[model samples]
Target: MAEILFPALFVLLALGVPVAFAMAISVFVALSFGSSYPSLVVVKEMFTGLDSFPLLAVPFFILAAEIMTGGAVTLAILRLAQSLVGHLKGGLGHANVLSSAMFAGISGSALADAAGPGSMMIKMMEKGGYDRPYAGALTMASAVVGPIIPPSITMIIYAMQDQHVSVGSLFMAGVLPGLLITGLVMAANARVSHLRGYVSGEAMPPLAEILRIAVYAVPALLLILLIVGGIRFGIFTPTEASVIAVFYALVVGMFVYRSLRIRDLPAIILRAALVAGAVLLILGAARAFAWVLIIEGLPQFLAQTIISWDLSPIVFLLAVNLLLLVFGLFMDPLPGVMILVPILAPISLALGIDPNHFAILVIVNLTFGLCTPPVGSLIFVVASTANLRPSALIREMPPFFLALAAALLLITFVPVLSTWLPGVSGF
Candidate 1:
């Protein structure tokens, strides 16, 4: 049964368990020899894989990023990304990668951009002297641009597991790989904020305080350019562009940034419905352990063991970028892209590739496993909001995880950097 169901759910997730109860004990140990199915078809495929209607765009983009980070549009996009990169040369490490690419467009949640602008850019890079574990390792490497931008709740659980792929063409193929990993982590955070001196100098604010922080961050960057230009011009369908980004963040948080009051809307809609009911109960127990690994064929025994190793779609996408960077340093990118993107999307479409460029190279190698150590959820949310010591923010995130594993090996063998804007939006 697919070798005793994914090695007993990777040995109960290496004994720590709890990846949604190790995907319901690997879908009841791969339906323990189904004699004509029905052990109630594993409780009706774990509640019909979260009974999706475009997975209600993952709790209205997690309650419109908890009502636009509960106030004045995340400190007016951190004072317009500190008046356009604070004053350069490591100006709070280029204002912590330009306020994490404008709070990864209104908090798509890399643990809320590593505990909200990585705990205020690691206490303003330790009151400007820096080195609090390299400002908690560049705010956990610009909190992996909160799941690579575009109002992403991991692209709404990868467009509710392929409804012919179009959460606005996977948010326009994550906008130039989230602006090329935010310009390669703000030019490696302005060269380690000018090699450790960690520059501070502030001034540049006035142009009427950068036009009143660009008119209160142009109504939250025009609700992320009208939900990625109304889902790239077709007008709307990332669940109707997440119900027009939760009624444009509730008409700009209750009448233009009044800071959303009605008793803070029922604890921000019950903390975004308890994190979208624990990510739709781990996307309905990893879709009944990916329908028992596609009824046990295991993607044609992994495409005949990679066509008996006659490799060369550039060495099979460089060994599938070292097996998705060792399954993103031990799983979490939406149940490892809902259990290895339909077994590596038919082995990268039988090596021709381009299933939306192998689903943006398996979500930029699962954001390089969130920043690897013992499972790096954005370096354990910037080492528990900068109190520090997830191995001292993994020695300040190994050179921003080696510039995000060299832009995930050049966007995994450059399928034109994720199929050139999903082929100019005509998907």
Candidate 2:
């Protein structure tokens, strides 16, 4: 059963089925044909998987992002980022990266970041005399930061998989690494600017103009600090924080920015529903697939095999990174988390690896996959939204990939990068 199950799953995936449906089909076939257990367990487990409260955050966070992105927020963020960095060498590139990071704080979904501010940045950078492919690559790269930051839908799903990890700790664990990725992006932008001989952005705006932009952008940016601070202070669970995010986005969009029309709510909810429903469906399907693996003793067998190797924690972590990088290359992070976390997380704990640290490493690995070639969803998103071929973006991905690799290494070897904030916050 073990041998036949996984190979069949991959074969189906390689045949171009959607990940969720592929997983369901593979498991259903394996169980009905090979296992002694009744196949009906698959439906039971899939329903059980969707029966999670923390999972509720997925839609709210997505809705909050849609609402904020529905109006003036993206423009304000672009203006603020441009005002602050647009005069630097590669300043437009810098603004593009910076704007995505800000949008990440609101959205926590790479696709949203890519489709929203990322598309805008690509056009903005192109208008500033930057190459189209370069702009697209940077947009996809920066959007990867979305799931690595606080209020992440990915982290929330990961928590549901591993009960030892609370959502708040995972939320706090992401802060430092997210900031590190931000810095790496800017550094990469500066290097590309010099090497490619891109022209500088517009002249540095006056300080008053900068101040005005920042002041106007304050309400939009405040959502980040509010979500983080509220979670850290124990004022709300990650689920509740998501609700606050929605209310805040609504108020700012309708009242402050005045860019969101009252009539727009239905469309916004529908969009969020489509995205959220897809995620939840994948999650349910993956859960059933995971149930098959557990009943087959695949996770335990693998865990014992690794333990018998007596690999040091450092070596083990490096191995895990390599493996996850490969997993990430072909898969979306949602199914990636649902499938891999259940199998690998307990092994890390057995090795005395910090679970929070391991979680961050896995999260970061899957996030970077969003920018990878072939199966990377965000790569396609950036290309279509920016009106370029996928090949164009692939040719420009190396520098950004290296920058992200560097940040991932820093987070992996430095456990404190993920643990410190969680510790201080009493988690």
Candidate 3:
């Protein structure tokens, strides 16, 4: 059953079926082909998978991101990051990183970061003398930060997978790592820019201009602070924070920014709905796939095999990182989370790994896959937007990928990096 199930899914994926439907087909094949179980389980499990209060955050965050993106909040963020960092060596790249980080907190999605600010950043960097592929590389690298920051949909899905972790704790756990990636990428950008002569040598926006940009961006920025602070302080649940984010985005866009008009909302809402619908469908399918594993006892079987190896926690983490990196290259993180967490989380816990630490490691590693080759959707998004080649993007990605490797190692080895903030928050 296992052999028939897993291979059929991959074969279908290779044959161009969507991930969600691939998962659904796999569920049916695994269960119905065997007399041990019935195919009726597929529909039930997929529906049960999405029936959750916490998962409500998914659509709300997508809606909020779409609203903010449509309102030019990303441009405001780019201007602020540019005014602040656009004078340094590789300043445009640095600004790209900074802008993506800011948008990360708002969007909680790598795709949104790539499609929104990321495309604009690539254009800016290209005009500033950066290589186009290099610019796309940096943009792709920075976009991963979106899922690592607060209000992350990936983290929320993870929390739902294991009741031991909460959305708030996971959100808090991501902050330092997000900042850590930001610093590492910026340093790498600066060094490479110096060697490659990619520095823009542009003048900084004046203090007055910077201040004006800051003032204009404050309301947009406040939404992040509200979500982070509210969750950390126990003022609201992460799901509630997502709701607040939507309302706040609407207010800021219509009144403060005056960029999101009332008439503009139908298109924005429709866009958000489509993205959210796709995500939920994938999540539902993943849940059903996971259920198939549970019914077959595959997780216990896999866990026992791992335990039989008597591996240390660090060694297991290293092995997990390698697997996730490969998976990320081909699979989207949503289904990856759904399918793997059930199998892997139990093993990690038995190995005495902190759930928060392991969760962060898994999330960050998979998020970076968005920047990698083959199935990296974000790579295609940026490449399509910038008219750059994936091959050239791959060639230009070494420095940034190395920086990401360093960040991943830091988070993997120093479990404290992922756990400390959650602990400090009293999680």
Candidate 4:
């Protein structure tokens, strides 16, 4: 049954069926003939899968991201980042990375960053005489930070699936690694800029000028703080924080920035609903699949299989990283986390690895998948926005991939990098 389920799903995905549909079909097939499980039980399990309060956090966080994107916040971050970095060689590329790091706080979804920032930055870079494919490739590369920073939708999904892992802790765990990636991007941009003879703006902006823009950007920054701080301080859970985030962004966009209008609300809600619905369906289906795997002792089977090789923790982590990277190549972040986390949770725990650390590692692994070949959503988004081929982006992306791989290795061995801040908060 297990063999049939995964292979059929992959075959369907290979044929270019939508991932959610592929998962649903696979689940149905698994229930029908793979095991002795009743079809009715599968249906019941699917419903129960979504019966989680924390799961509500997914849509609200996604909505907050949408609202923030539609508001002045996106422009303000871009402006501030440009002021700071737009004077250096390949300055615009560096600006893209900085803007993504800043916007990661505001809009937690990488897809949002890729579409919004990638569109604006790619055009600006082209106008500045940077190669279109280069601009597009850079945008796709930096957008990876979106899910690795605070307020991430992926972190919310991780929390919903694993009760023992706190959303707040996962959020904290992402901060340092996210910053490291940003730095790596900036370094790469410097090299590319120097080699390509990229030039900064005619005049460097004054520090006071940069500070003024940052001041105006206070509202968006506050929204991120409100959500993350509220969660860590126990003022609210992830779900409550998400609700607050929506209203906060709405008020800021309307009253403070005046960028959001009444008409925009309907569109925002509709778009958010579409994204939320897709995510929830995937979550529900993955949950059902997870239940079946556990019932059939899949985790134990996997653990025993790994033990048969008599590997070390380093070997095990490396193998898991490779596995996740492959899974990420074919699917989006949420589905990969939903289906695989449960299966590996027991194994990771038995190896004395922190589950929170493991969750961060898994997400980071999956994050790279979004930039890989075939179905990498970020790759596709950046390519389309820049009118470049995925193959083109692939070439420009390998250096950043090296940086990301190095960061992954650091986080894998240095669990304290992921755990210290969360532990300090007593989460």
Candidate 5:
């Protein structure tokens, strides 16, 4: 089945089928032609994949992001970020990076960040005399931080796959590395802005005005603390925290922000449902796909082959990083996580790598793929939102790509960056 499974999957992908359908169809093909197993096993495995209680968090978190966007919480975050960094060199660029970090706490998805606030930042940067492609590129690069920060949808899915780390620990573990990625992207922006002679047109707001903006944004900002702090202190489970996130987004959007209306909710709910449905379908397909791999003993075979190499933990990590980087270029992070974690994680455990550290490394590596070509979802989102060509954005990506690779290497080498916060928070 492995023979038919992989080739059929690649052929479907090359023909431009969506990843979910590609995986599902490949599973059907593999079963029908390559094995005696009934094709009904595909449906069974997909349903089994979606059966977990923790999987309930996926839709709630997604809906919370949609509500926050509808309610104008995203605008408040943009204002807060602009005030803080809009006066710096390459001011709008800096604000773009900062706002992504802030929004990551709320959205938890890179495509969400890129499509919502990231689009807005690109327009603002163009108005401020920055090149359009550069703005789009920066937006795409910075938006990868979405899943690296706490309350991440990726982390939620990841925790379900690997038992050694809980959702809360992954949430806490993501903070420093997310910020590290943000900082590197910002530094890249600063260098590019200097070379291009981009300067700030907006002066720093008065202290009183900045204070007012911060206070206005407080309710939205507190959602992050509420979710993370609540989970860390055992006040709520991550699943419960997701539910609270939706309610909190609702209250903040409709009443506090006054941007969301009662009449607006149905559309918001429908949109969130569509997005969540897509995500869940991918997970279901990935499950059936992984079931094929497991049944064929692909994971055990690869694990044993890698283990027999007698690699050190550090060497094993470098090798995994290279494999994931190439893998990411062809796959989105979510499905990548579902398929690869099951194979790579046990190998890392046997190598004595810390689970939290290995988890973050896989995540950060795959998230980078969202900005790469051929299958880079964030690249398309940013390109479509900003009316820029993907080639233009890709051409402008070298500096930011180097910046992200540097950060990945740092996370790969410095285990503490991914583990420290979780450790201190008692995870």
Candidate 6:
């Protein structure tokens, strides 16, 4: 299985097979050629992967994000972000970063963030005198916060993979780091804006108007507090919180905002269903792929070998960071989490690293991949949404990439950044 599975997986990926299909087919090929086990095991493992109560949050959260987008909650948040930051130097760029952070609270998926609010911000920034590719790159970079913040789909999947970290714990753990990444991206935007002579064209809004916008945006923003607070206080489980989020978003979009209509739900549901289906497919395939590795005892083999190296915790974490960064260059975070968490998480635990800390570090590292070249999904989403070439976006990515790398290092070396909130919150 070891000999046949990895090679087949690589070859298929090199052939441009989708990650989900590639993993599933690799499992089928490995089972048939390298073991007496029937191919039925592959199907069984894939189905088994999707069998969890907590997993229900995946689609519900996705639907909530879709509903919010269709209902104009996203636009409200963007307005609030703009009112707060749009008066600063490089105003539109700051607004882009701020909106991505605010939107990340509602939309757990990075691609959704990039396509929805991110696309809008790109257009706004370009109109405000920023370069098109630069705006797209900033949007792509800032949107990585979607998965690092609370209500994260990646963290949900990650919590499922590693039991030591609960959804609530991970949610609390993510707050500061998410803010850290947001600040770093904003700083990068400031530097670029300075160099390019990007200046604010609009004056700061009057206090009364800022207050009104905040008041209007509060309902949408409360959804974040609702989810995180509900889970932290045990008012609801993360799965239940997700369901409540859908209803809450519906009410806010329809009643308060009057942006959502009954007629609009079908299309929203279809889009959410498609996104959810794709995510689950990758998870299922990754399960089968990881199952093949477990059967081959590769995890144990590698764990034993690494444990024998007598590496310090700091050294081990730095090494894992490097490995994950490289791995992320090729894979999306979801599948990357599914396949690698089972292998690397146990090793981190053995090294006495805190689970929540390790989990956030891995998650943050993989999200960077979403904005990276070769397989950066956010790059493509932003590019297509903004009508810019991917190469153009990539060319503008270095400063933002350096910022993200700096954030990753902070999360890696300073476990306190990831663990403290969870600890204080009683997670």
Estimate, for each residue in 264-337, the C-alpha lDDT of model 3 and write its tens digit: 98999999999999999999999988887777789899889999999999899999999999998778998999
Q: With candidate 1 superimposed using the best TM-score fit, by how many Å does residue 415's alpha carbon deviate from the native?
A: 46
What TM-score would candidate 5 get against the native? 0.99
Question: What clash count goes with each model?
Answer: 0, 0, 0, 1, 0, 0
Residue 184 of model 2 has an lDDT of: 97
Per-residue lDDT tens digits of candidate 1, residues 275-353? 8898888878888888888787786788788878878777888887888888888778888888777767766676777
lDDT of 6: 0.91
In model 2, where is the ten-residue run with the lowest total lDDT? 1-10
lDDT of 4 by residue, 1-427 (tens): 7787888789989999888778777878887887777777766777898888888888998898888887377788888888888888888898898988888998787888889866888888889988887788788878888999998888888877677788899998888888877888788778887888888764778889988988988887788789878988889888899999999989989998899999888999999999999888887777776777777788778878866787777888989998998889898888888888877776777777887888889988998888888899898788777788888888887667777787788888888878887888777
Highest lDDT: which candidate? 5
Screening candidate 5 with a backbone cut-off below 3 angstroms (N, C-alpha, C), the clashing residue pairs are none
Clashing pairs in 2: none
- The alpha-carbon RMSD values of the candidates against the true structure, listed in the order shown, are 19.0, 1.3, 1.4, 1.7, 0.8, 1.0
lDDT, each prediction: 0.78, 0.88, 0.89, 0.83, 0.94, 0.91
Ranking by lDDT: 5, 6, 3, 2, 4, 1
Looking at candidate 4, the ten consecutive residues that score lowest on lDDT are 284-293
What ranges in model 4 sit over 4 Å off?
Answer: 36-42, 307-310
The residue ranges of model 1 lying beyond 4 angstroms of the native Cα positions read: 1-7, 11-25, 33-47, 59-79, 88-94, 105-136, 139-141, 144-195, 200-203, 207-209, 222-241, 246-329, 333-369, 374-393, 397-427
Tens digits of per-residue lDDT for model 2 on 328-417? 877788888988898889889989988899999999998888888668989888888988999999999899989999998999889999
In candidate 6, position 259 carries an lDDT of: 93
State the weakest 10-residue window (summed lDDT) of model 6.
68-77
Runs with alpha carbons beyond 4 Å of true place in candidate 3:
none
Scored against the true structure, residue 117 in model 1 reaches a CA lDDT of 67
